[model samples]
Target: MRIALGVEYDGSEYCGWQSQPSGGSVQDALEAALSKIACSDVRVTTAGRTDTGVHASYQVLHFDTQAQRPMNAWVRGVNALLPDSIAALWALQTTDDFHARYCASERCYLYLLLNHPVRPGLYHGKIGWFHQALDVERMRVAAQMLLGEHDFSAFRAAECQAKSPVRNLTRLEITRQGDIIAFELRANGFLHHMVRNIVGCLIYVGKGKYPPEWMRKLLEGRKRSDAAPTFSAAGLYLAGITYDPKWKLPHFVEPPLAALLPRMSRPGQSGCNMKIR
Candidate 1:
């Protein structure tokens, strides 16, 4: 049987989302728990592979298990075996055709900036809080330019192995709450490091380090060097994934992202809007 698992994790404790050789990872931890439950090794496929120190509030993965375990059994069993850093929020029975990665119709990411005079020890690993004060208004203006189909090569990490860089950025919004600055991006797809790199460029603009219009030029330029530095992975998270209802997976929603991004009329779906922030 196929099982879909909704996972949430604090990426600070692990190497990354994918299984690693030298260190621990969300994949390694989850696989360990699943192996214990199934009494056999299980390999799971995720909707996205986040970089080291990147977090996920609602990441999805699927694995094929022949154990005939009940959905609640898999959920309770995995949670029992897994550490506090990672969690299997829920498990659902899925069709053989349902795939967590390939079947995903959209992916969303949120990048946070701590704009203050000093970094708060309270949010040390959970947020990307910088000492420099960010102009959230300017960042919002700059983020709007990225709200359409484009070749996001400039924002992609050079090490990214994706075959293409073209993606439809359905939404990009910047909002501020006191010292917290958040960049929310939704897309039909994302290239590796796309959200972090875009946030880097916007930060430059916010700090008066780059022209406000430079982001649009950089997007058109398609040169990776034209973009800003890749922002810290601490602030980036796999906010959510969208799929057709036929997938039979429950929405793994989080409160932080729910209040930050614009909510659509339907759950686990996005509306067709191109207007930027």
Candidate 2:
């Protein structure tokens, strides 16, 4: 049977989501625990491969297993052997056609920025920090240029293996509450470091280093060098993934950061729980 799981992780201690020969990856830890549970070698696939230090609140993945244990076994059992940084949130038997990556329709991400003179102490490694004051209104205006279908080559990483640079960015919402700023984006797909690169450029605009229209120019330029440097991975989170309605996957719950901030009155400015298109 095919089993799908909702996984969450603090990606600080391990490598990225993908397994490597060096062996400190969320995938390696999960597969090791799962192999013990299934009594056989098991391979799994994920909806997205996050970079090192990138967190995920609701990462989705699937594996083919013949072991007929109860669903709780997959959840609690696998989690038991996994490290404290990784967890299996839910498990469900899925159709053979349901793939974790190929079947995904949309992906959502959140980037948190702690905009204060003092560096973050309590939330270190969990948020990006900027000492300069940022204008949220300018950042929001700059971010609007990224919405809809476009060639995002300017924001893609050099090592990106995706066949195409064109992606449909359905949403890009920016909001701020006191010293905390949040950026939420939903897209049909993302290039390597795309969100981080966009955030870097937005930060430039927010700090008055560039005009909001500079974002449009950078998008049109289609040159990676024209955009700002890639932002830190510490603040990025794989918020959720959307599959076809037929799959009926559980929705992602809002993380506590949302409740701590006042709600923005903008159209797409809902809390951290992103709306899937």
Candidate 3:
């Protein structure tokens, strides 16, 4: 049986998603837990591989298991054996051909920047705090220029091994709430560190080092050196992913209309449950 698992993790202590010789990885810990649960070796393929210190709110992975255990057992068993930093939220039986990575239609990432003289106590490890002041409005306008299909060679990592630099970016949003600046991007695909590099360029625009109009010129240039330095990995998070409805697991039915209905209440009223599925 093939099963899809929803995951959340704090990447602070691990090396990265892929296993490495020097240190532990998210994949290593997960596979170890799975092996213990199933009493057999189990391997997993993830929707995306994140770098060291990069977080994920809704990452997905899939694995093939023997027909002995229930899907819920796979979830609970793995969670029990896994460390507190990583979690297996849920597991649903999937089709034999379902692939967590290749089946994804789009991926979204959010890069957080805390631009203030001092950082917040609660978000110390989760965010990048910069002492320099940033102009959010200018960053927003600059990011819009990156909203369509383009050759993103300039914004990709030098070590990126993607076949092509062309990608369709559906959304690139820059917004600020108090001193927290966020860059949200959605794309059909992303090259290695593509979003972080793009955030670097937008940061330059916010810092008055790069004009907003310069983004268009840089995109056309296609030179890797034209973009700003890549931003830190600590601030990046794999926010979510979209898959074709047909690829959704069999037992996991979409929520019913009654459950999907939204409530109308005053702004401060408390009974609200917004579920995205």
- How well is each residue in 1-277 modelled by candidate 2, as lDDT tens digits? 9999999898888789999998999999999999999999999999999999999888999999899899999999999999998989999999999999999999999898878777866667888888998999999999999899999999999999999999999999987755668899999999999999999999999999999999999889999998899999988889889888899888775443453223322233333342332
- TM-score preference between candidates 2 and 3, better one: 2
Best by lDDT: 2
TM-scores of the models, in the given order? 0.90, 0.92, 0.88
Q: Is candidate 1 or candidate 3 better by lDDT?
A: 1
| Best-fitting candidate, scored by TM-score | 2
lDDT of 1 by residue, 1-277 (tens): 8888998888998889879886498899999899999999999999999989998888999999899888887888889999988878888888889888899998888776667676746566777867776777788888889889999999999999999899999998887655667678899888988988998899899998987889889988999987888988977888889989877678644324443323222233343131332
Instruction: Pick the winner on lDDT between candidates 2 and 3.
Output: 2
Residue-level error in angstroms, candidate 3, position 194: 0.8
Q: Candidate 1 deviates by what RMSD?
A: 6.7
C-alpha lDDT score of every prediction, in listed order: 0.82, 0.87, 0.80
Model 1 lowest lDDT segment of ten = 265-274
Q: Could you give candidate 3's per-residue lDDT for residues 1-277 as a string of tens digits?
A: 8889988788888888997776499999999999898899999999999988988777889999885788778788889999999988788888988899999888888777767776546555677666788988898888889889999989988889889999999998776655666677899999998988888888889889988998998899998797888888877888787888887543222222113123322234432233424
